[model samples]
Target: MSALGVVGGVLQPLLVAAGAPLLVGVMRQVRARLEGRAGPGVGQPWRDLRKLLRKEAITPRGTSEVFRLAPLVLVATTLVVAVVVPFVTTDSALDPVADLFAVVALLALGTVAVALAGLDTGTAFGGMGASREMTIIALVEPTLLVAIFALSVRVGSTNLASIVASTLHDPARVISPVSLLAAVALIVVIVAETGRLPVDNPATHLELTMVHEAMVLEYAGPDLALVELASAMRLTVFLGLLANLFLPWGIATTATALAVLGGVLAFALKVTLLGAVLAVGEVFLAKLRLFRVPELLAGSFLLALLAVAASFFLA
Candidate 1:
């Protein structure tokens, strides 16, 4: 790879890691405005990160080392996953190994680690959250894989870069009903996976209703910051995948400077529009009861399976 390529690879994660929190801030701002409340500044997340970093970490008396380490693992896994995803460009250094299945596996690994750590804390809330989280994952992952398989069938490859390349090579594929179904299924998966509205509420602290938040209730200081950052990055990564894989309009297939810049702008625009849609969705919907989450995910799974069948018959 050229020096610019190497540099671009290194910068991708940094940009995503930083941009993730900013995206959260923006979403919050939008939500606040819709709710007629003045939101915290867009830089609020950065301030929170800095404050968390400076505070001393406190572990519960009975907590194991795994609890202490989970935050670091969460951040590291998110960073690694972000690098593997085709964000600004398809020429990721890690693209060769970026199989869609492997990406799903990595995400599952991170989820399991966090859930285990949550249960390790011996808190009722943490354990409850972990249970809910695993249940959601069980319902969501299959649908995610099925959606990806739908795309894989069209592109004839499971590698994400290849999928993007195939779609770019034939833009008309996006308008197919199979593509539309897959996109819809993936969007639902994204909402469920990212702890957004109608599935889980990211803004709530209620123990009974909070799945992701309950799991991290025991985390404090730098550990909490890392987990929070990881959550944001995870959201960004999934949305980025949805944008680039389906759209792929301006994503760079080669390591050219102008192409990279165009890819960056296109990426920002896509994610911003997605974030706005998410905000509006949250505004219009209430969080589902824990029991109802499974039904929602099941519908997504069926849509994804239908998408696959459609691709087979139509493509």
Candidate 2:
């Protein structure tokens, strides 16, 4: 890591922590407005976090250490990702420490922590949610890896920052069919991974229907706050990665102060716009039945596979 990279790594978490709540709140507010209701404003997520923090955490009787540890692990893993991935600038200090494969592994670790915690509680609902989440992850992970493989194959590196820098240096890469197909597969993964519409509805409380909510239904107070914050950060990190990877034009390549500032502004705008697009997309799309989700993801997987084939065959 260059000296500037160290500074960037330090600042990345603070930026992510500050912006995640606002992004989540914006998506919620926008979606609500689309649904014809006066939704909670963009400040709502921050308020919700504050309200949860002030309350006491109450763990249930049948839980163990895993239950208590999972929330912290979840937040910690996501914080590492926020620090390593090129959020605002392509000059990533932690680049070698966690490449694209490492990023996926860290996220998987967080998922495992939560899933184990869910199972540890032994609640029927928790088990059901964990089972469903694991199933989805199993199906989606290959597509995620395949999509990355396609991008990396095009750029000749698995490092995300390198890929972005390479793609920016070669404008023709943006128009490649491999890039488009990979992006389509990735967008679908983002929808599924973030528990958004047409997959698992984040806002729903239907006992038999909600996948993400059911796992954390037993959490309250500070623990719940941590889980919620980590979830928001996860979505933010994903969107930031998507923005930076596909639209690398405005990202800062150097550590100059003014350049960094521009990169930050550009990244924020890109991610916020992505969030708005997803929120609006959700307004028109209905959530699919649980069984149907696999079919949708199966299509995504095929697209990703084709993306990989195109990169190797067409190139």
Candidate 3:
């Protein structure tokens, strides 16, 4: 790999690891401020992670090794994605793993790990949450695949780096119907996959409505910290993908230190803006009923399908 590629490979994961929590904190603070409350600073999530790490790790009774390993698996997969995705530079550290299919599978693996862990716990809420998560994933993964495929069809490659490079080369595609429809489709999957508002509220404690939270109820201390951190990182990965896929102007094309630095700054700025917008929008929206979520997801799927069709016909 080139110097810039190596630098990006190292820097991307570090930024995602360190910045994910701050992103969550920023979103929470934005929502709080919009609602006229004095919110905790952006460092609050980091503080919480630190505190959780210092606490005693707990394993619930009768739970198997799945419970113990899920957190690590979740984090491990996300970290790999942070490395492979073209967040900082187009040069992938592992080109073989930088395909759109591989990235989506890695993400799905993390989700499945947590769901299986929840099922292992043998609790009513755990099973409910696991089932609900699987339901969402069923709709989510296909839409994510089809939407990205829409972009790839025009580029003639499924490799994410190639797609990003193509977008950078043909800036006009950004305003095309295929791109716009894919963008809308991607935005919905991002919100759903990340457990954001109008799909699954990340902050809610009520069991009736819990999706992500319900699955992790048995976790405590450091394990819980890992889960939360992985969750944040997943959001960061998705948002970063969305930003770079659609508005890839500021991403570094040349292999230079200054260019890489610019890419980092651009990435952070884009993701923060997206997170803030999502948070502000959430303030004015309520979580959709569980039964209503499929309708929303199906609508997104249709958009993705349309995008794919448009890409082929318009091209």
Candidate 4:
């Protein structure tokens, strides 16, 4: 990679780490306003995270090192993904590691770490949450991979930068049937992966119904802050990848200052619009019953399958 690419590696994660919470805050604010009340402002997540950072950490009486280390692993892996994805500039020193499979595996690493920590906690809620989260991961991963396959088949390269570069050079691909199908498949994976509505409620404390929250329920202080921030960064990274891959209109192809600035603006606008779309969706839909979630995920797999087929056939 060039020096410019090296610079991008340092800058991309900073973008994700600093800006991710704002996306969640925006979504929450939108959701609240839609319910006909004044909502927590867009800065709410940052404030909540700050509060968690100042509190005391409360570990359970009989937990192992896994419980203590899992949050760090989760946050670390997500930051790696944030830097590796072509969120700001397609040319990045990390491009060699930005393969579609690698990105998915990085995400899976965090999930696995968190799941093991959940099991390590020895709480019924933790076990229940781990079980549910794993189930969702199983269902979500195939669709995610296949959706990547659908997109990658077109360019013959699974590299995130290559995919974005291809899409950027050919703006018309955004509207193709394969792109549309893959987009649908990915949007479903995003909702599932992010613990958004119709899958898991991020704000709920209800024991039986919560998935992600249940796993992290025992965490406090900096650990909880890291976990929350990691969640936000992961969601933002996923959305950034989605926007850059499918609608790569303003993604910086080069490492130039002006181009990068434009890319940042484009990235913000796209994710903000997408977040609004998600919040609107949450308002209209109810969470699926636990038993019915497999059906929802299975449907996602089918959509991804169609996307792959369409990519091959349409070409």
Residues 133-196 of candidate 4: C-alpha lDDT, one tens digit per residue: 9999999998999998898998999898888889888889999999998898899999999899
Better of 1 and 4 by lDDT: 4
lDDT of each: 0.85, 0.88, 0.95, 0.88
Question: Model 4: which residue pairs collide?
Answer: none
Better of 2 and 3 by TM-score: 3
Alpha carbon lDDT of residue 40, candidate 3?
94
Best by lDDT: 3
lDDT of 1 by residue, 39-117 (tens): 9978899899999999999999898888988888888877877777777777656766578888888888888889999
Quote the lDDT for 236 in model 2: 93
Candidate 4 TM-score to native = 0.97
Clashing pairs for predicted structure model 1, backbone only: none
True-vs-predicted CA distance for residue 17, candidate 4, Å: 0.7
Can you give the TM-score per candidate against the true fold?
Answer: 0.96, 0.98, 0.99, 0.97
Write one digit per residue (lDDT tens) for candidate 3, span 1-67: 6666677789999999999999999999999999999999999999999999999999999999999
lDDT of 2 by residue, 1-315 (tens): 786677668777888889999999999888899899999799999999999999999999979999999999999999999888887777787878558889998988998899888898899889999999999999888888899789999678898888888887887887789999999999999999889999988988998678888889899999999999999999999898888778887777778888788878887899899999999999999989999999999999999999999999987
Best by TM-score: 3
Best of the two (3, 4) by TM-score: 3
